[model samples]
Target: MCSFGLKAALLGGVFGLAALPAAAQQTKVTSQGITPTEIVLGTHQDLSGPIKSWGVPVTNGMKLAVEEINAAGGINGRKLKLIVEDVGYDPKRAVLASQKLVEKDKIFAMVGPLGSPTVLAAQDILLEAGVPQLFPVTSAEFTYKMDPKNPQERLKFNNVPPYTDSVRAGARHLIQEKGLKKPCVLYQDDEFGKNVLDGFTQALADTKLTAAATTSYKRGASDFSSQVAKLKSDGCDFVVLGTVVRETVGVMAEGKKLGFSPVYFGSTATNVVEVPALGKELTEGFYAVGGMEIPYRDTAKGKAKEWAETYFKTYNMEPNTQSALGYNDIMTFAHYAKLAGKDLTGQKFLAAMESGDVFQDMFGSPPVKFSPTQHLSATVFLLQQIKDGRWVVLKRDLTN
Candidate 1:
């Protein structure tokens, strides 16, 4: 195993990238994590922090997938090993976790690392080491945007619907149908929140309107009174939320207490089951953007329904959107890895992922189409609303 710090210092580079050697950089994607009978993979998620609502269940789903695959003889007859590190949604810790995974664990690929800032901070290390960053939980634009001049970027692929596109589609639809003008935005002060802000701004631009007000809160904050009060005071008839499950519930519940009734919208991250489950009456009629259907066991059908029930039986907990997505992410990885054939390498996996294949999940998500030049899985978005504690699709095939 190569030391991550030593690799950076060897070339006096920053983030192990600034001064990479030409020959080594050209052949970075080798079969590092492959063994005669096993293939090791890695991921980082916020298991103990604010976003654990997402991390815990997502990891549960991944574990379930690994079990399923291993029992079926694994991918190409080699069992899969997933090493998870809890980053607590902290970027610095994310980097250190990435170092440990890449250098010490010698993971072949980094799959489903959580958070926008954390993935951003740690991705260069994975890329520098020639390990592919696949299906990261974040939908930040940089995750899928390949730099034409950098071949290393070709290893990056994202399966999640982007925040910018999802919010833009939902916001635009609401503005057109409801004729809402006094738009306000309450966002977390971070990379994820900024994308939401940008999307809402673009939507307003399309409808020839401007924001009535915008406020931000720090990540992991439990109090949203001030931000809610600010938007309420601005007379916002519609508000865009840049929040995850907890913050989403917190802001909306706070708004209800303050009698701030308006159309509330959120990006894909808020489209999970927790939003409706936690907020209940407070979040009724809340709108959100996403590409995957929230897998409610009672309402899910076909393979999706079966999977949800099996998940509950195995884990003794109800399955959510993140759970379905995490399971799907691993299955998708296996599909491509299998296509990479028995001789698996980072280069082969990259080619397999970019082989113009369309992957569909059991949970009725938008079809994931990956091509040689296109890394983003889905571009179209869906608008859904929480009605009677369940998400109902309001519109489909929405675009920016």
Candidate 2:
């Protein structure tokens, strides 16, 4: 077998199926904790391509988490070994990458593989392999949505909260908390946008509040003048958005040009780098609810402190929401892989994860809760807004 370095040697054994001899076990085993030295896992990201907007930082976050775990003597003394492939948010590439990770890398679990379409592509393979997929980066409902057409879809598990969940919370806060009544809706016309709208509707269902006007844009659209005009004509008091960074800025720019200076509310994606940078003045009142904490806060402690220090120390960049979330996904799974202990098959690790023993040890959000029937974690989210080119927490679920 190929040498797995000093960390592997310290753990004293190789991962293999129960039937294999120790010498040959390393050659064939695909499960984690089956060996003392290493736990193999897989992930897909947009490391070197167009989607690197999120892929680069997210990948770095996962790397930092894995490195930190290994330095801390690993889970049960077994170092995590991640095999990452970049899919650039392309669905076909994601599917291909996922297949290779399962068939060739022999990973015991999966993490990341960002973007809604990419995750949607890789979903079946992960489920069929029975490998635990922890904390994917997308908020698409289908990431953990119950299959309406096929009852079996409920078996899917993910650590990400529903996109709708955040949207609902944001909408409610916009109405009840922020006192924005006649809100307009702007969204990209796709699965992610639809989910956000669905949540917004559900939040105002009881109060009979609805969008003053709604306009849709394609995912990569660079212009939002027409949409902004509609909202302006409708006299919207606020505008809720279901868009990625590019469109978020575009809408804000057009709204500004059209003299529609309404407070902005958006999906958690608004907390990313572009929103505040491109729409500085307009993004001031922009609110988003998501998993990650506001970085550089004094109260940052425990996992948050660790992540903040290590992330900056290692990479020299502040970890963003996507980055923190990506890191959490991998480390939490590694925690479960260790808990499974020396027999880390898919079944064993999945069972361990389902036990919900490890809380969200990362710097953001509350601890997680998982089970056979529930794989999503951090059901609650913190509300944040941009102030002076940075994100700050505005409100948090008191339960955490």
Best by lDDT: 1
Q: Candidate 2 residues 1-400, lDDT tens each?
A: 1234322422322222232333322222235324568878788998765457788888888888888788898877678888889887678999999989887777776777687778888888866665555677888867665444443343355666577887787677668766777877888787778888887778778447877887788766787888888899999987788888767877888877877788788777667856787677767767777766755634577767776777777887866667777787776776666655565565455445555454556565677766544557657777788887778787787221
Against the reference, the lDDT scores of all candidates come to 0.85, 0.70
* Candidate 1: segments with Cα more than 4 A from true spot: 1-27
User: What local lDDT score does residue 46 receive in model 1, on the 0 to 100 scale?
Assistant: 92
TM-score of 2: 0.84
Worst 10 residues of 2 by lDDT: 9-18
Clashing pairs in 1: none
